[model samples]
Target: MLETINRFLQKWMLLIAPSAVILGVTIFSWLSSYSYLVKWVFAFISFVSCLGLNIRSIRKAVMRPFPIIVCLVLLQLIMPSLAYGIANVFFANDPYIIMGFVLAYIIPTGVVSLMWVSTYNGNRALTLTIVLINTLLSPLLVPYLLHFFIGTQVSMDTYGLMIGLFWMIVAPSILGVLVTRFLKEKINKTASFLSPFSKFALIFVILVNGAVVAPYFRSFDGTVILIAVLVFIIACIGFIMGFFTARIFKWEKGVVLSIMYNTGMRNNGAGAALAVAFFPPSAAFPIVTAILFQQFLASIFGRLANYYFHVMRRRIDRRQNGLTGI
Candidate 1:
């Protein structure tokens, strides 16, 4: 029964996300009271998602440090900068919302990205390494990046943000890794059991966070629509940038797939959590809006990656056959 429910949730996740947002909006008053629980839910999500990570994969991935470095730069520095610029150009009058845009991109790459990477036959080691390293560093990087980019515009509790990220992301991640190390094969069943619970928890988090941003939807006018459009465009750019950057570095298709997913998918759950916990409600709006589009975009990009690599393989095969006079 648990497995059946898990399979159903995983199969229909793309539809579920947006539906949760709508449901939250409809019942905003009831759900908004539970907003404080967002942090706990996110911590649980972080813990369960990290259960599948192999510590040994980190060592293997680090041996090829250049690709990892490239991904980190794209994930942390380049994307946030792009988001900041785009947000400012369009919404200069709305600093909180602009802060929302920056926050959405600067958070670490999503652990859920591992699912996408695995689905596309990506480099699991590389994806795991990137997720672990980026997540561990988020407590530090997120605070500093927020201060550096939008500090003057909005007052933030930097210390609180750090501690929150530590407990919610870093601490839970470490515990999950330890379980994987010690429990070994035993933990696989445990992780599998918890996987569906984690998804349900994520849905709950989205619903509650969506309630926090319900006011925005009530006044869903031109500005709101524009923000949604901009968010979608920026997300598309992340995937495109990751793909070309890998191609430019002459990385293999597997690495390209890993980097593309990592670069493209933000830990929006974490983003929404921080937005609600520390920043104004306006900030959470963009993050919640991102939840609606993220999984759908990932599905589309996965197909695009498949088609892109298939064509490349066909061309290579043709060249080889021509050379052999076949």
Candidate 2:
């Protein structure tokens, strides 16, 4: 029964995400009261997401660390810098909103990226390793990156934010990895059983965080529309950047797919939690809005990547055949 439910959720995830946002906004008042649950729920999701990971995969993935290093540079430096520039140019007057844009992009890559990578036959070990590294380091990287980009304009609890990430992301991730290491094969069955529940927990987090940014939608105007548009465009650029980077480096198809999803997806739940806990509602706005589109975009891009690789394979085969004939 749980497997059936998990399959259903996976199949309809694109619709489920936007529906959760709409439902959360529609009943913001009731959900807003339970804002305290975000951290705990996020921690649970993080834990569940990490259940498939183990130290061995991570160690193996790091043996050739160039791909991981490239992904880190894209996630931490290049993308956030682009976001900061775009936000300043468009929302120059509102520092909070500009910070929102930066926060939306700077968070660690989502564990959900693994789901997409698995579905597309990407390198699971590489994706898991990147997720583990980024998530573990985020406690430090996120706080410092925020301060570096928008410190002069915004006053944030940098220490508090770091601690929050550790509890909500780093600590739980380590526990999950340990659990996987100990349980071995049994954990796969357990993880499958709990997959549906974890996804439900994710939905709950989105619902509550959506409520925190409910007020923004109530007075939705051109500015809100503009922010959403820019956020979507920037998110698209992330996938493109990763795809081209892997291609330029002449990586395999699996590595290219892994990098694309990792680059494109952010752990918006963590981002929203930090935004609400540390900054104003404006800072959470871009993140909450991102939740509405992340899965949908993932679905679209997954298909595109598949088609691209298929065509490339065909062209390569034809060229090889021609060379043999000559």
Badly placed stretches (over 4 Å) of model 1 are: none
Model 2 / residue 218 / CA error / Å: 1.7
Q: Write the per-residue lDDT of candidate 1 for residues 181-209, one digit (tens) a residue.
A: 88998988999899999999999999998
- The regions of model 2 sitting more than 4 angstroms off are none
Across 224-303, the per-residue lDDT of candidate 2 in tens digits comes to: 89989998999899998998999999999899999999999999988998888888888999999988889989989899
What are the TM-scores, per candidate, against the unseen true structure? Answer: 0.98, 0.97
C-alpha lDDT values of all predictions: 0.92, 0.90
Best by TM-score: 1
The weakest ten consecutive residues by lDDT in model 1 span 23-32
